[model samples]
Target chain A: MLPRRIYQFFLIYLLGILVLLSLKYGLQLSDYVIPGPKTLWQTALEVFPRYALDVWNTLQVALIGQVMSIVLALAIGIPGRSTTWFGNFIKAAAYNVQAYPIVAIAPIIFILLGDGFLSRLLIAAMICYFPILLTVLGVMSEPVADVEHFYRCTGRMRWQLEVKIRAFENLHKLTTVIAGSATLAMAGTIVAEFIAANAGIGYSIRIALYQSDLARILVALLLIGICLSVYQGLLEHTGSLVKKAWTGSA
Target chain B: MNGKTGKRNSLLAAAWILIVLTLAVAGAPEGRAWAGTLNYRLKWIYNASVIGDLYASGKGYFRAAGLEVKVRPGGPERDALRELELGYADFGVASADQVIRAVAKGAPLVVVAQLFQVNPLQWLYRTGKGMIRKLDDLKGRTIGITYGKNDEIIMRTLLAKAGIGRGQVEFYSVRLDYTPFLRGKVDLWPVYANTQAVFLRDKLSRAGEETALFVPGDFGVRFVANSVVTSEKLFKRNPELVKRFVGALLAGWKAALDVKHQKEALAILRQVDRDTPLRILKTQLEITRRLVMPRSGPPLGTIDFEGWRQTERIMLEQGQIKAPVKILSCLKPML
Candidate 1:
């Protein structure tokens, strides 16, 4: 799965590059508008190491952000799974927070938090937790009738047991959603850096953008793609392991 | 027919090709006019800084010149140079650094007219914290600069000229919010002298604070600002069209800057910039006039060749561009 993900990303990146190249040559565009192969290669050589480090920094934030989002989502989701007023209130509040555009709120965050790592982490979690929370809420709310019925009839259906049964039954769905959200986490972190943060691949890309250096941006995108693919692949692999262990198949 | 007849026909064909090539090189006739809706993209949104451009469009100067120009606004994401290459815009406003960098990378753009004779970019600081009487005053100050922006290049140039090392002063990364500057967290925040300077000074004034501007030009750092631009191909192919457009634009500027037409210009600005009060817009326009057309300065839209060269040299010294782009060659001033 990891190898497949890497190759698939490679193919997509290659296709995107080819399309840019075709446009460049087709329209007789200069390197400023669209970087030629030589310029792109030279830019890669120049900025690769710096951008790699930056991407690693971004990924670290993203990984922590993903974990935080998962925790926050599960915490809210598990408690809000009930049909009580507290659950409904929590759902409405989370939805309201999501409605406010992050771009609008990012300035306040930066002003309060000073555009540091903490701000990036919070923005990333804010962006990534919503979809995960929705899925968690759906999965937690829907009763697993057959398995949950066994626990309920014998009066063994405590809230913990109820949650365990539901989570166990929907383990595959939960794993898929969590793995899928890695992209969101990375995207969120990037958006944070692009808006205000000073130390990440997104910030570097912002600098390149200001300079109108398409070659540098292309190089940054390549590194970001590779790093994201590898991280996501590892996440899926870990999720599979967790599933196996949970089912006693490990 | 005789062989002489065939020789005469071949000579005629060659003469026709030579004539056509010569005409193409000399450019189309001065009398010739192009009739089409052309796109003129500004570097910023519709604000007092773009009064002349808006005046031109709103007052039908484009139509008077026998052209239909769609004056489009630019923002952070809108790149006029790229748009020119992609054939989306016929003309644009770009800063000297942008033009030089684009040219360094082989983007075939030509500057036709300079808008701001005195660049509007300056650092605004509160008056209480001792004036920047000399370059030495800049040391030990926490300055706000957008890391990958023109202000950074200008500030670095200023610091280097003052013989200040990187460790000598503090640099705060700036963003859209001015909370840091407002709360007195940073000194020497960059702002456009004509627009943001006016706004910020007024805001600080209400808070019982006095402010001053640090003009880079005053310190002999004359970085060129917004200027009219177009593709080199368009400039070469239709010199008459370029001439007419620039002529109309400068006329619009001259008229807009005229005190008699202040009401008209303000009305046009009010249409788009509804957020700013009329009083502030008036002040911005007055400040803009000084930058766009300084006293004893050249006529409106006059290309500042020396200023552009100095700007290019600064960029080169600062490693913003890998090498000189021969920026003067790209200054195909219509007037």
Candidate 2:
């Protein structure tokens, strides 16, 4: 084994090297956003207040997008297993949407829908719809022949049976699909925001690039990271609540 | 199995609701016939003097043309040529080097109108640091060159003119943010004649610090700085549209050039450069106008072959460009 003192020194040296490198190239991302260092701190501080509302707008869009994607997945998935047509159509739509890049479609959406919450919402929905739909379809269509036979023998009403019993059975799969949709939806909103927004994190980044303020760019990235973390935390919290509710009902 | 399908139907309804919610947010666009149509990419950002000119052109004259020019202010990602290539923009405000490089790379971009008659490439240093009085002293000095193809090309040429060889001078790619010149960071940096230098002076004036500016034009490297460029396809397809567009722009330039229009142009630029003081902008515009305003021999919008050749030779020597580009093909006459 290496000596303890030597290991400590090596670790410190590596950390020091990493710190130096981050400082050196850290400005690269910022240079893409803001151009020069002139009055950078002041400019960033001033702009931060304006972005509060923009961030709120982004969050709202992402939340709606996640919900929509989850819903789409279930709708397509449920009927898909019954008939190949339903399954193929849903799968094809998802794949086709994914095939075209978001950047290409965003401007057109802005043109058609006009620049506002609606255009961004549609862009986000388009993004979230495919993945969730596919997931839900797969989960909902999973082997349930035994459950169906039991209900049939009992002559239970299909509506009461589906609502009261069958829906609760696939809780784990539903939770997983929803989690994935949330992540995908966030990505969609940000990418869509890049094209037409006069405000939001995307607009801020775009302006930061033009001005050449690297610090502001990094700040925006940091803000996105925070937003993602909070979103994930919320997703997990909601998942637990869902699990608890399902357990209590059962 | 049928029960799962029932639940799925309800989820689909939720998705539709989301789409409707988004529709609710997209209200009618505010004001004007030309709104949301035009997109413009600037060569740089709000701090540059050209922004005022662009703003004046867009809001004042170009609006009359029914063109709502969205000035996409530039930074590192503001590759004017790339914007055209990606179809993100209709037109771009770029430098000659950008146009030349794009053309070299098989991009069919043409310079529509010349904005700056003289380029603003200069070395800014402390009043007395090393033997930097003449170009030759630039040898072995560490120079800070931020970004821009022209900055890199011109600095190389200025060094060559001073008899400095490759490896004679160390280069720091970091921009001079008026930070204290650390020995390891850089020795000198290329500064714009009006903006960066003036910005530094104002900082000094406000905080009671001392600094001096050295203009590159004084040392004999004068090339046109900002030029209006569009795709060759656009030019060919709508020659009259291009002419009409340029005609309106020239009027904006003429207005901006006048002493009276300085206040209006500065106000427009301030929308972008909230950090840039008006007094400093006026000083920069005055100095830059003097340096870049057209001379008697060459008419406005004229590209000097000799000037182009000098830049071409320097770029070739420095390995900035592999092959020399003929400058005449790049020019689009306004008349």
Candidate 3:
């Protein structure tokens, strides 16, 4: 029997294809506006070889930004759970950062950082930072009292108790947050590229829009969707594995 | 409490109705006399390039022709041709490249009037850095282009004609900002000669620097620029409306190019685009006049058939279009 999750995914995918087919053949929309799936496939075949560099560039930006954001979030979030003024300040700053719209501020970020890889990286990192940081802070602030008492009875140091026991206990949450942030990182990287970048999938999409090449535009969008889906699937798999190992159950 | 108060209320309601009827009767002639509403989608934001369209509306030309025209400004993502295709706009301004590409894709679009006699796509380089006196000077220079833009086509055509190899020069991709050129990172940058070139020259002159424009027209690539366009369905459905709109638009163009009406045109343009400085608008208007009505060319708004044919040939040679788009069939000049 097929897995329930697998069945659901296929159902959604087929529904998407159905809608596209209806738009193309049923409604008889112009090919210029909405090209059929066959044309899109042909365009992908033609564009992918030429767009390999763009794919690689976008992947690098997203992956690098995701890793950096995770590290920064952990470094700040653990200490931010402390009952102190500085900790409260850090918490407040993270909330503030989440309030600003990334798209509106992207141009300002580009101006300050200049239009290059660093600007794109910073934009992606900014987007990925808050969710991971907030999740870490939430887990740390609500540590299990029994675990704390047990560690205290064992005479463990504060750093050791917090880092070794508390973090390990919340491994599921951390992995889940990381999984979620991965998607945001990819989206942010693409948007940053759109605002200012010479090479990336976003740049290719912009060029396609200017040329009014509907086939190429659809191909670029499909590639972006594929990239995000693959990354999310890997992250989810890793997250499940971590959960299973930590809890000693499937 | 019943009959007296009800009679007073009825009297007040009747008086209000009489007043409304009087107002409607007085305003009906002007309000109901409009022939139709024309949604004109411009190719870019309100600037000197669209001064003629703005001028026509400002001078009551569209209204005089019994039409209510809504002049809409376009931006980076706002494609005039796309708006026309989607039925949101009745008339639009698009470049020859856009029109050709749309027609090639079976868009059923037709060009009604050519705005600029000469294409405005050109390269701007600092004269103080190094003069591009000859075609060979372009070799080894870092040239900036917005890939997939008409400038790319024009530049490639120029290079191919001059026998320059692709590897001879580096092509940089330009974005919305001009910082790369301003920072000396790019040797040459593409710009609309009449619009952006004026602003760049003014900015550079203030900094004690000089810049020179490399017009592709001077290099034998006379691609047509912005032209008024409408869908074939609309053109066939109401040719009279098309003719009236074109007539008013061309008259506005003539007036805009005339020195006597320059002040009036600039005034109208400034009302739409207040951010641009007055001096910059003057300079832009002067360059725009030269482009629209060259000393030794056809009068303003004349559709140059040879120019369109050459543009198509260049696009074909560059492989931008896979097949020939019947250039003349798409051009229906009502002016």
Candidate 4:
């Protein structure tokens, strides 16, 4: 028997294909509106080689932004876990930042930063920052009474304990947050590229849209989906390995 | 089988039939008893650039031609040709360069009517800050360009022809907003002569500043601008419909450009786009009339094959397109 997760994935894809086929044949819709699976596959094959550079450019921006976001989140979120006014202020700012939509903020970012790689990086970081910070705050604040008592008995500094031990104890949550934010980072990068960039999958999509090349647009979207999935998959796999090595579980 | 089993089978058959019927209805277009529905996707937002299209629809010209027209506005993300390809739209407006590139990529599109006889794309620079008496003045000046757009292609071609290297002029990436240009960061900015340039000029004039327009045509480039297009399949299958649509569209253009019908055309345009000022619309209409039907040029909606060939040639030289797109085959003149 197929594994449960694989079977579920297969079933969803099968349903999508069935719907496309029904639109193509049952209703006799033109190929322009909903292309058949075969056409999509052919388009993917044709455009993948030509657009590899755009994909790589997007991936680089996303990865760099993700790393920057992680570092910034840790710097602020760890201190915000403390009982101080500054910490509370930092938490409040993160929450406020999360409230504004990226689309609304992107044009302002472009104007201030002058439409360069920095603007794209800042946009991606802005999107990835809040989620990671909030997750870190949640994990740090929810220390178990028993764990706290044990750590206090050991006489370690509270900040040191929180940073080295408490945070480590909740590695699973941190990993999950990081994995989730990867998608947001990718999306933010694409949005930034769309508003202002010299090169990227987003730029390619814009050009393809101008040309009315649906096949190229579909290919770009597929590549983006594939990029995000692979990134998420790797993070999850590595996260599991780290969790197993640290906690001695499969 | 028992009575209950028989009843369940009958219900299942009915459900399947209902599902099929619903799907069919959802896929089909909304029923039109007499007039054929034509979805026209414009290249840009509802502005002076698409005044003719708006006029035609608002004045019942399309209705006279048996077409119930829906003039949809396009933006940065909307590709009229892509919509045409997907059957979301029956007609679209795009630049010659865009049409050429699409055809080279195997899109089944045919140009039916050319709207702008001379391309509206040109560079605007502040004359008071510095004079650009000759092409050499462009050197060392910061030029703003929206890369992957036709302006970028035109600018690069101009530079190459002028023997100017990439390092001579700094290229700034242009966004939809003109803050950088307004703030004097960019020395030269690209604008549609008949549309955005009118608004920019008005604002600058109010600030007691003067600007000089640089026409690419004057500088040795005659690339065609917006043109009406439809799928080749439609052109082949419904030649009569294509003829009627083009005839009505050109008639609308002629009226919109005529001085006598200026107020009516602008009124029609205002009905669709209320944001643009009346003064700007009047100036834009004047400029558009000149561009669409110059005193010595072909009439409105005439497809100039030589202009298209030049556009394709420029694209090929710039490596914007891989190969020469058969320009002649893609053009289907209905007027």
Each model's DockQ?
0.29, 0.03, 0.12, 0.17
Candidate 3 ranges beyond 4 A from true positions: A1-21, A24-29, A79-116, A137-173, B1-36
Task: Considering the two chains of model 1, state its CAPRI-style docking category.
Answer: acceptable
Model 2 DockQ, alpha carbons vs. true complex: 0.03
Q: How far is A159's C-alpha from truth in model 4 (Å)?
A: 7.4
Model 2, runs deviating above 4 Å: A1-250, B1-36, B66-68, B130-133, B147-149, B166-168, B180-185, B205-210, B294-300
Q: Per-residue alpha-carbon lDDT of model 3 for B176-270, expressed as tens digits?
A: 77878987889899998888989988888899888998888877888889999987778888899889989987887788778999889888878
User: For model 1, how does the per-residue alpha-carbon lDDT over B47-120 read when each residue is reduced to its tens digit?
Assistant: 99999999988999988988789999999899999888777789999999999999999999999999999999
List pairs with backbone clashes in candidate 1: none
lDDT of 4 by residue, B1-335 (tens): 89999999879856765676567558655322224578899999888888888888888898988888898898877777766765778889999988887777667899999999989999999997577766777899999887778998999988888899989999987876787898898989999999989999999999998998888898788889999999877888788888988899888888888899999988887887699889989999999999999989997999999889889999999987778877888988889
Reference-based TM-score of each model: 0.93, 0.50, 0.85, 0.78
Q: Which candidate is the best by lDDT?
A: 1
Fnat (0 to 1) per candidate: 0.71, 0.02, 0.27, 0.21
Better of 1 and 4 by TM-score: 1
| Candidate 1 backbone clash number | 0
Ranking by DockQ: 1, 4, 3, 2
Candidate 2 residue-wise lDDT, B1-335, digit = tens: 59899799768756755554444333312222222566677777766557445755646687887665666777666577665644566677876665665554456677777766667666666544554567776766678764334666677667767778878887765422334252224567667767877776676557654555555666887655677887676778777777777777767766766678777777776766787678887788786666556445354455556666665566567665568777668777764
Q: Specify the poorest-scoring 10-residue window by lDDT in model 1 chain B.
A: B25-34
Give candidate 1 misplaced runs (Cα > 4 Å). Answer: B1-35
Evaluated on chain B only, candidate 3 has a TM-score of: 0.87
Q: Indicate whether candidate 1 or candidate 3 has the larger lDDT.
A: 1
- Order of candidate numbers by TM-score, starting with the best: 1, 3, 4, 2
